[model samples]
Structures are given as C-alpha cells and as structure tokens.
Target: MKMLKMLSVVFLSAMIFTACNDDNTTNGKGKASIYITDAPIDDDNVAAVIISVNSVEANGPEGWETIDEFEEPVDIDLLSYQNGEAFLLTENEMDAGTYSEVRLILNIQEKVNDQIQNEGSYIEYLDGSKEPLFVPSGGQSGYKAKGEFTIPVGGVVGVTLDFDVRKAVVKAGNSGNFILKPTIRLIANQDAAMINGHFEPDNLDSAGYNKVVAFAYENDTFTESETNEPAEGEIRFPNAVTSSVIIGGDFTLAFMKSGTYDLYFASYDENGGYVELIGSYQDVTLEAGTKLELDLELNLLN
Candidate 1:
C-alpha cells in the first residue's frame, strides 16, 4: 500500500508541471521575436545597404508598445561588418492582453577598443572632435516608432526602411561631435497604416551638409525620352513642384498619384556641385490599396 501511494504522488507532480508549461506557451499567451535583416536598395550603379525590421510575435494583440527602455545592457560590436545586425529578447513577455501599441528600444553600441567607429569607418569632426555622429562609438541611443499600429496574435508584422547610404546625410548637433546611429522602436495602435519616420537635421558647419533634391520631367516627350537613361536636363514643363532639396535625414516625396517620373539628387559642398542620377524615367504605376517604397542611392562626384 505504501509503495502504491508514493507512485501516485510522483505521477500527479509530473502532470502539474506539464500543465503549467502548456499554459505559458499556448492558451493565448507567450512572447514574440524581432528579426533584423540587412539588405541594399539599388539605384543606378550604386547600391546602398540598410538594416530594417522583419519580426514576429505570438498571441499578440492588434498592437503593442516598447517599455521605452532596455531591461539590461545590450552588447553591440560595431567593429566587424557582421556587428551591424543585432537582436534583443525581452525579459518578460507581453501578457495576453488587448495591446494596441508596438514599441521597441535600441541601446548604444558597446565599445570594443579605445577608438570609436561609425558606419564601419574612421571619422573626423568639425571642431577637431574625434568622434562624429551617425556611427556607433558608444553611449546611450534610441528612437521611438512613429504612431501606433494594430497587430493580430500569431500574425507577422513587417517593416522595411529604405535609405540611400551614399546620398543619405546625417547632421550632428551643435557640438558637432560624437559617433552614433539612429535607434528606433515601434508601437501598435488602431489604424496602424498612418505611421511614418521623422527626419530632422542639426547644423554644425557654415559650409553646409549634403541634401537630396526632388525633380520630375516637364512633359511626356522628356519623360519617355529618359526612360532608360537616368540623366540631368532642363525642365520643359515644370509642375508646381519645380525642385526641392534633400537635406537632413528625410528626403522623400509622397506620391498620391503615380506614373512614369524621372528623379534625381545633387550634393553641394564648399567645393562646388556633384550631380547624382538616382533613377531613370521609369513607369511607376501606383494603384490603390498599396504602399510604395522606392528609395534609391546615387554617387555624387565633387
């Protein structure tokens, strides 16, 4: 009789443990993962690479928010090219709740050697400051996601940030010193389709920094003529938007109506001007119920 009782007790304990685990993983509960991908968007002969998000969460509500802080220090090695990619697992999972905001936080890169690095290259600042901005050297860093979005449980949330590295320019603060990159996080909310990334620039030198310019062909003949060759020429029929400069981090035009359009960008330094042909006159058909993300990079020779 004693032996039988002992056996029964052991069986009950095992069953209890198993049930608890199942409750954590299933039953409308558990955590998600934020996957990162490094790819380049091509333009003309230049290819600019950027790291964007491709993450998923389980049993998540239509939306979620990042706590705005990291639970612990995340080690980011900025030296090796491979270090450009990173991921952090949340300490606690988002409980099974109706969340509407999806948030994320990115910590600064951990220092490897005495010297700091940004964009995998050595930097020089205006005030003779050793470290420059827009590269990972070390220090506190991060950016909040734009607005809220709705995400369903067991669903995948996809986001891609297309940037022109060669033509993309970042302005440093008044100090004009320090190495860092833009850190970002996202939150979920109702009508999540209205999210956008804000681009702001700081002035450091009187000579000025690089900027992107927006241009479109004047008439049907000009646009069709340059369909294959992305080149610069005089505008024959200038739309109300004759031209605009691409300065700071944001240099994109929203296309409510899309067709074939020729686009180009230029850079101006004290040395003079360098023209960059971003894309040829291609027929870009923008239809309803679609999000068009066409970011291109170009080389500007001074």
Candidate 2:
C-alpha cells in the first residue's frame, strides 16, 4: 500500500465499472452500493475540493478484487457532499463474503506524450485561485479506507467512506503544494451515525471567534493534541474521528461509526489558530439512521 505522509482525504470521482472475473465469484452473489462523503473543513479559503478517481477496489480472499473502474475520469467536488450527504459510486453484485479493506485509485498521473500529466484533481479557493493536489502512487489501498464488510448472499450492502478532507490534506512543508493523504473511515451504511444540531451562542457569533470547529472523538479519547497547535504537516483535533465547521449557529459531524463519543467545540484565536476548548458535550451515543440533535450554548473564550 502507498503511504500518505501524515493524513489523507477523500474525493471519490466515481464511475460504473465491470465486475470481477467469474473466478472471484462464489456460490451466491451480493450487491454492494458504495458512496463517498466528506467531513466539513474549517478552512474558509477552501471553496471546492475536486478529486478524480479512476477506480474502486476491495481486498478479498481471492486477491485484489475489482469493484468498478471508470472509462473516463470524473471530477468530483467533495465539498458538496458535506452534512451527511453521500455520492453513490456503484450498486452492483459482487463475490459474497467479507472484505477487509476498500480503496480508491487515482489515475491522475497519466502519460501524455511520454510525460506524466496530472489530470483534474485540485482545490479551489474562495478567491478563485486553484492548486492541484498531489496524488501519490501505489497499490489498491491508495486512498486507505479501513473497515470490514460482508456482502450478503442475496441482499444489498451499502457502505459510505467518510473522507475527512480537513485532515487528509496538508501543505508540503513551506513548498505550498497540497498533498492528499489517505485518511478515511469505511463504514457500513446500516451502522453509520451522525451528530447534527444548532448551537446558537447566547453572546457569541461567527465574528466573535476566528473559527469554531466542532470535533467528535471516541469517548475519553481527547488529549492535548486536539487543542494544541498541530505539527507543520498536521492540523488540530488530530484524534477527532471527524469534525465540522460551526457555521450560522449550526454544525454537523457526520458518518461516524456507531459508538460513544465526546463532542468538543474549539474556538480559534485572532491568528486563526487553535487557542482553547470553549464548549463540550460528553458521553454521546449515536446509532445509524438516528441523528443526535444537540442544543448547545457557547461560552466566551476571549
């Protein structure tokens, strides 16, 4: 598998592909509907995270199984799939059984005139500026989505890979080049859950703080790394499974695997950097199809 330097992101530019060979099929076939979505990013400058995926594959007992491949590279805007929204890749029958991992392959590095050319994976800023995201090369685990799923004998199994774009994307040192890391959660759609709610502060507004990023971490897993300044190639809330920007007195953390979590709100300082943890919601249990709606209040930090 290709290693991402630090974190990773998801931009599944999905297209229909033919199924695997008959040798990989079993006595019974099952259906799989794969989708991709992204967690909210706090970077206000980021307007669109466009990614181009050439194919989707799974690791099976028979070996690397092909789920689907694209005849044409599709440019998918990950930012559009926020707030629990998902983009379906394909819904086709496959070998019945369990697969340990799922990954997305980016064919951006194409040889044109015997030269490596990056196709259409880049980030668009609010100011109309753009920069291409550097996609690394390697095995089927290029995107690094981790999970275990079983395609039933005669039923459909739907899974959504939550790409935490905020974490997966980091600038390469002082080079200004953004690298797309492989950091994603492969969650069974039936067991995936989300946390969404309104948090209108009594005396706080967007202008009060530079930024308010809501993070969801496994219960009691939050450490100082979450609030402290991140390393040169990392971001705060490093331990958070997922996070979202608190906008218009509303925020959402979506596609979390079923579990107990601690939701914390951190307000950035004047420099637009993490300063302190201002608000929190502890011991929250979430399940699929159910949204944990929280009515929260923000406290002054500055």
Model 2 per-residue lDDT tens digits across residues 112-161: 56665765788899889988787566222467687998777666677788
Best by TM-score: 2
Q: Local distance difference test, per candidate?
A: 0.30, 0.72
Q: What is candidate 1's lDDT per residue for 1-302, written digit by digit as tens?
A: 00101112211121111112455546554333332211111122222222221222322343333422443543322211111122233323345444433333333223457554223222332344332234342232222223232222333222222121222223345645433233322322111111011223442123245544444332343433332332232221223112334445443332122234444333444332433443332333433222334433322211
Candidate 2 is scored at a TM of 0.83
Worst 10 residues of 1 by lDDT: 189-198
Find the number of clashing residue pairs for candidate 1.
23
TM-score of each: 0.34, 0.83
* Residue runs of model 1 more than 4 Å from their true location after superposition: 1-27, 37-72, 75-106, 109-142, 147-149, 154-169, 178-273, 283-302
